[model samples]
Target: MSVFADLHRGDEPLLLPNAWDHASATALAAQGFRAIGTTSLGVAAAAGLADGASATRDETLRLALALGSQPYLLSVDAEDGYSEDPDEVAEFARELACVGAVGINLEDRLGSVALHAAKIAAVKSAAPDLFVNARTDTCWLGDGDGDGDGEETTARADAYQRAGADGVFVPGLTDPADIAALVERLHAPLNILYTPTGPTVPHLADLGVRRVSLGSLLYRRALGAALEAAAEIRAGRAPHGATPSYDEVDALSRRGDLTHSDGP
Candidate 1:
């Protein structure tokens, strides 16, 4: 396993936060997060588009180019490889690899599991060095665990693993037992989406999960915070949280480089 893959093997599942741009990614890396992921929703929203619907290919690439030279490991959330055609998806994978991304989260949210599987295989074939975290959406869209248990969750994850996925992700899973069972059945590493009700990092590690992704959770929360701050200010009330200084953000963007007269 690659060091990135090895990081997920510990009892503590790696907690991967998704960033939308260079500054967000650099900030997280500065905070000592060894691995950072890109959020499709954030990228799509920033481009005035919808996510998980095959939009924002160029925008995703633009963001990748911006993030490629950052000092942290990057995993990109490229929804369905942005096409149904396997060849195109594989080419996309090659491009992500060229940009120095260490991981890619490819999902089957739009149906056509076989096509998604082909995409996964193609990405792995083209970029053997990149970690391919395959995602199955049975619980996110189907009737998995109508009673809210995790049994049905395992079946879906298993299917993806059988298709040659390095790891399987279930975005809407929350129950701990369900998570543990899914981990048990999933031969490949299991990745769960983090929810307020879901197991925390330590709890997930105990459940045998290898990875936990924030998905669009952070981006949505940031949007929520922005709305709340604006509302509070409009209501003549002070914001209720600590805010980062402009200097801090500028530093994340490497102001020293911009101010330099010599080549970096």
Candidate 2:
């Protein structure tokens, strides 16, 4: 198992933060985060493309290559693997693994369970070591209120696990009972998206969540902070929050005193 996979075995849940670019990732790594994940919305929005529309495939790969060399584990969020064809998705996973990504996240987006399972199987066959976090949007895009029971979610998760998924993610699920139930049912590690109004990190750890992802939340908040700062300056007021100095931002590129780790 990879280091990233071992992170899920600890006493507490792995609180994974998602980054959009090199600077964001480096800043997060500077805070001693063992692993970082890419957000599909952040990547697509940065390139002015639509998220979950199968676009930004090249952009995702390019970003992965750039961040793969950093001294921390990197996971790329490939939206639907950029294609419905299992072969194409498998090839994409292979390239990501070749570029040093230890994990890959593939979402179903409420699509066919069989199709997503096939994609997971193909990815596993092509890159067996790549950690595949199979995501189901049943609670997210399906019933907007996050009210869907665990029947469909469990069925899909079961299929994905059978197809060799390292973990299963159910975003937008907030109910504690539902979360605890899923945790008990799934054999693979259960990953949940961290929601501000939902369970806190410690509470999630108590609920048996192996991994907690701040999916696209950090990216969106960064954009919000930038805009708010600009607005405050325009209004002739000083900005709040911790702002890095120019030298500090520039130092992210200069890797001179830093020892690079060979990531899994």
Candidate 3:
């Protein structure tokens, strides 16, 4: 198994923080996060495009190529693989692997289960070493009740695993009982999206969740903080919080010999 895949086998669940840009990714890596994932929403909104509509394919690929040279394990969130065709999805996965990404997240927004399974299979067939985390939006785009009964979710997860998925992700699922039940049923690693109102990280680990993803939470929080700080400055109040100095922020741009000589 690859190093990124091995992270899920440990005793503690891997806390994967999603990054939108180079600065966010390297800052998280500086804090010792071994694995970093790209948030589709972050990339889309940053590029002035809508997410989950497959509008950020080029942006996702560009970000992957940029972060590929970094020291951390990178996972690209290719929403629906940018194509409904399984072959195209598989080729996209291969390209990501070639660009140094060890993992790719493919989400099925409550689409046909068979189609999603085929996509997963094609991805594995194309890049056997790439860790495929098959995501199901049954709960996310479901009836909005937060009740993730194992019926549709389990069936999709089963199909994904049989299709050779390295892991299964069910975002917007906050029920501990439901999460535990799904974890017990699925053979592959279970990844749950971290929500402040949902079960805590340790609680999810106790329930057998192998991975917990922040899933755009950090990106949204960063934006919120920036807006709040700007308001505070406008009110003539001192802004609080740990802000990186100019030099510290500049240091993150130093990628070996590729250094920026321009000043702020």
Candidate 4:
């Protein structure tokens, strides 16, 4: 198994925090997150594009290239692999692997199951070592807790795994019973998206979740904090959080480089 794969088999579920840019990724790595993921929403929003619409492919690749050489492991959220063509998606995955990305997340968006599976298989064929977290939007796009939805989720997950996916991600699944049932049935590692209103990390681990992804949560919270900070300044009140000094942020920008240079 790969190093990234080993993270999922640990005692506690691998808490993968998604970063938007080089600074955020290095900052999270500085704080000791061994594996860092790229958030598609964060990437798209930063580039003034839309998420889940196959936009921001270049922006995503750029971010991956910027951060892939960093110390932490990188798992990019490719957002349907940026195309409907499985071979095209596989080519993209190959580029990511060449730049040192250890994993990629491909979502179905409740589209054609066969096409999604084909993409997964093609990615595995192109970048055999790259961990593929096949995502299905059944829970995200449908009624998550219904019995019929659970069956659909299971069917999709099964198909994805058979197509060479290293793991399965169900973003909108929150109910503990449903999560446990899915975990029991999946042959691949079960990845659950961590939500504020959902089961706690330990609870998910107890339910047999191998990976817990903070998908867009940290990026959204970071944006919220910036807004709140500006509001507090306008109101003549101090912000209520640990603020990093200017030099601290500057240092983060130069992480992994032997010496800092004034020119870009």
Off by over 4 Å in 2: 253-264
Q: At residue 224, what lDDT does model 2 achieve?
A: 98
Better of 1 and 2 by lDDT: 2
Q: Which parts of model 4 have CA positions greater than 4 angstroms off?
A: 144-148, 255-264
lDDT of 2: 0.92
Q: What local lDDT score does residue 209 receive in model 2, on the 0 to 100 scale?
A: 98
| Highest TM-score model number | 3
- Evaluated at residue 253, the lDDT of candidate 3 is 63
Q: lDDT tens string, model 1, 195-223?
A: 88766778888888888898888889888
Better of 1 and 3 by TM-score: 3
Q: What is candidate 1's CA lDDT for residue 164?
A: 63
Each model's C-alpha lDDT? Answer: 0.80, 0.92, 0.93, 0.93
Q: Estimate each model's TM-score.
A: 0.90, 0.95, 0.97, 0.95
RMSD of 4: 2.1
**Residue 49, candidate 4: C-alpha displacement in angstroms:** 0.3
Q: What is the C-alpha RMSD of each candidate to the true structure, in Å?
A: 3.3, 4.5, 1.1, 2.1
